[model samples]
Target: EPEVTQTPSHQVTQMGQEVILRCVPISNHLYFYWYRQILGQKVEFLVSFYNNEISEKSEIFDDQFSVERPDGSNFTLKIRSTKLEDSAMYFCASHNARGGTGELFFGEGSRLTVL
Candidate 1:
């Protein structure tokens, strides 16, 4: 079955440095999302994209954070300036247009560590 895939499964960066995480979502899915989990914290929603535009975003998705579907297949999240608090596992997820039950298929995630 098709699945979401992410790169740089683990990364360690200094605070204030730029970081970009990449993902390739399922081919047929129409909606895409980015979520993050801070160590032992609950999962938090960052943003959602559909039809090439941001459909919704949470406050956690500040100006420093941005998402793009640069080509037809890759979805990416860029943190213009990483912070110590930004250390977490960032997940890329997607779902089909049907939207039944709002199930999301998620990638294993790219772990970001800032010091």
Candidate 2:
């Protein structure tokens, strides 16, 4: 089965630095989303995008964050300035909107550590 793929399963960065986490979503899916889990916290939605523009974004997706589909297969999340609070596991998901309720297929995760 086709699956979402994320790179750099683990990363350590200093606070206030820039970081780009990469993902390659399932080939045939139309909608993509990004979510993060802060340590023991519940998974939180960051943003969802379709047709090359943002469909919805949570408050957590602040000015310092951005996303892009740089190619047919790759979707990327960029943080202009990271913070200690940014340490979390970022998961990339994709789904076929044709299904009435969205059921997402997620990548394992890209774990970010800030200090």
Candidate 3:
């Protein structure tokens, strides 16, 4: 069985530094997304990418954030300037199709810590 994979399971950074989170989704999946959970907060949808462009994004994905599928096999999310509020567990997910009954495969998540 295939699954989403993320790198650098935990990262510690200073406030205002840049961070890049990477993900490799299931090979057959087409839709990819980034979500985040801040400590004890609920999970929040950040952005969804498909066909090499953003299909949907939440307000959280603002000027400081960007996402890209750099290659056929890898997807990445970048935060230009991290803030204390940016500390969280970032998850990567994928599905064969959007808004379908098909389940999504989620990565273990990359935890970002900003000091």
Q: Each candidate's lDDT (Cα)?
A: 0.96, 0.95, 0.95
Q: Which lDDT tens digits does candidate 2 get at residues 1-115?
A: 8899998799999999999999999898999999999999999999999999999999999999999998878999999999999999999999988865767999999999999
RMSD of each: 1.1, 1.2, 1.6
Model 2: how far residue 18 lies from native, Å: 0.5
Q: In model 3, what is the error at residue 76, expressed in angstroms? A: 0.3
lDDT of 1 by residue, 3-109 (tens): 99999899999999999999999998889999999999999999999999999999999999999999989999999999999999999999997857768999999
Give the Å shift of residue 109 in candidate 3. Answer: 0.3
Write down the TM-score of every candidate: 0.96, 0.96, 0.95
For 1-115, candidate 3 gives per-residue lDDT tens digits of 7899998899999999999999999998999999999999999999999999999999999999999998799999999999999999999999997556768789999999999
**Model 1 lDDT-worst window of ten:** 95-104
The top-ranked prediction according to lDDT is: 1
- Is 1 or 2 the stronger prediction by lDDT? 1
Clashing pairs in 3: none
